[model samples]
Target: MTDAPFQFFDVEVLRTERLTPAVARVVLGGASVSRMASAGRDQRVKLFLPHPGQREPVLPDTERADWYDAYRELDPAVRGVMRTYTVRELRGEAGELVIDFALHGDEAPAGAAGATAHDTGADVHGDAGTASGPATRWARAAGPGDRISVLAPVQEENGGYDFRPPEGTDWVLLTGDESALPAVAGILESLPPGLPTRVWIEVHDPADRQDLPTKADAEIVWLVHGTSPTTTEAIRAAELPAGTPYAWTAGEAATVKALRRHLVGERGFDRRAVKFSGYWRRGASEDSPMSAADAEEEA
Candidate 1:
């Protein structure tokens, strides 16, 4: 049987707000956005950004037999850059959805020209420079009437680090950088009430931490860089309580990998009980091709 065809939808920015100095929340809306209500939390979708002057992006006809070629033949300028981001929330009432942007420091690359343009002027650095690419620039500038392109959610077989607590596990361990915030938050919000869970998050500062409503008993430890000598390192140094605990970790590729080794290899935690992912790698550009060296090192 043929695989289900991928669906593409066009959307527009309805509003935006700064959640923190480094995080910006963008709400997208349009008739097509209502369909996203079925998307699962933590599911990632590709965002396509139009060129600086274009009002809207033209998506390839995935239905065509030569869709791949057609996609390749599209004008590079209008092709719109792509980025993998999670669906934070989907509201059917206004056909609105939200995604958060981790503003890279001024040294980072500038984003494309759309929803993100207005905020791009700030001198943020890090992956944001190149990571933002075109979609981020467009996202920053995106306003109530701005039009954008969105593809149907692509559910990966093992796309994200799962956080569902294992049966019999009494404790939970959660760790990641700012990029992992959305997924971490989604996991925390979905837990069953009265379950005991402990979360450790590493961020640039204490302010990056946000209160999450959950029925499960949770203890959150926020690790801040600069103030804390070892932000990510502290997570590794932390001693897990005596008991089988479900662990979830994601963040910079190298750091997450280190924690994975410590928990599973050194600490002897069951590999199946832990979920870990590398959201991004330090000093790497989104446009740069992935390399074997990077993979081997992270592994």
Candidate 2:
């Protein structure tokens, strides 16, 4: 965690747009998120989507580690779908918070299927399992005026933010599948202008390719599934700059693990300089203890 403690707020949907066939862009608006100090890049926020036909989402009045316990006490039908995601863009002047949701993917398109547990990319569960989850299904049909609850980072320590770049590091390396797009995009925006970098993103659909804006000297590499190297392989193939290059990689659990191993164990990249995480695991749903969000919550 890179920021302060998190606080809960009630927010309404200001608008929704289709970024791609499988991705939905949602803007959550209100004084809570709009007036919030920027949580910074790659910060995490918990979204409590409303139950179908319900006007508001059910949320716990507690905080710290107790909130999870209290939230778990609610009826599943009323609790709705509780998932985590990265803050894509912060619009303080407009009093809005932009979040991209990768719509549900398992039985349909994968990337941008549901608001991913980490980023706005992919969902780990299939439609059969996600059919009842409010986040995915609600995102599929969510419209303006619909409301949800957001647990955003507070100004105190351990507030659920995740960005951490070491001081004096010269260059950067970033890799992830579609599931990490939102975080990666936000990170790119935060980097120092014109810093040399390498970015590798893996996605199944060409439409998932986005025109990510960055002031860094970023070389964008789109690794299309079935054609380009595996996300890990692509990372292994990329050339990092000289003198203490920091790397951050994420996405599917197994692949992220493999990339970490390749960077540290095999390639001799400094262990402390490489930041990686498993965004989601293959063949696992958000309910599984192995899912990324579950692990983070428990941590």
lDDT, each prediction: 0.61, 0.70
Candidate 2, residues 219-288, lDDT tens digits: the string is 9999887777887777667666777778888777667778888889877889888877766654445544
lDDT of 1 by residue, 188-295 (tens): 777778667777776675655777677888877887755664534675666657778888876666666778888787778898897766556544433344332343
lDDT of 1: 0.61
**What TM-score, over all chains together, does every model reach?**
0.79, 0.85
C-alpha positional error of residue 188 in candidate 2 after TM-score superposition, expressed in Å: 0.4
Candidate whose lDDT is highest: 2
| Residue 11 local lDDT, model 2 | 85
Distance from true position, residue 62, model 2, in Å? 4.2
Q: Pick the candidate with the highest TM-score.
A: 2
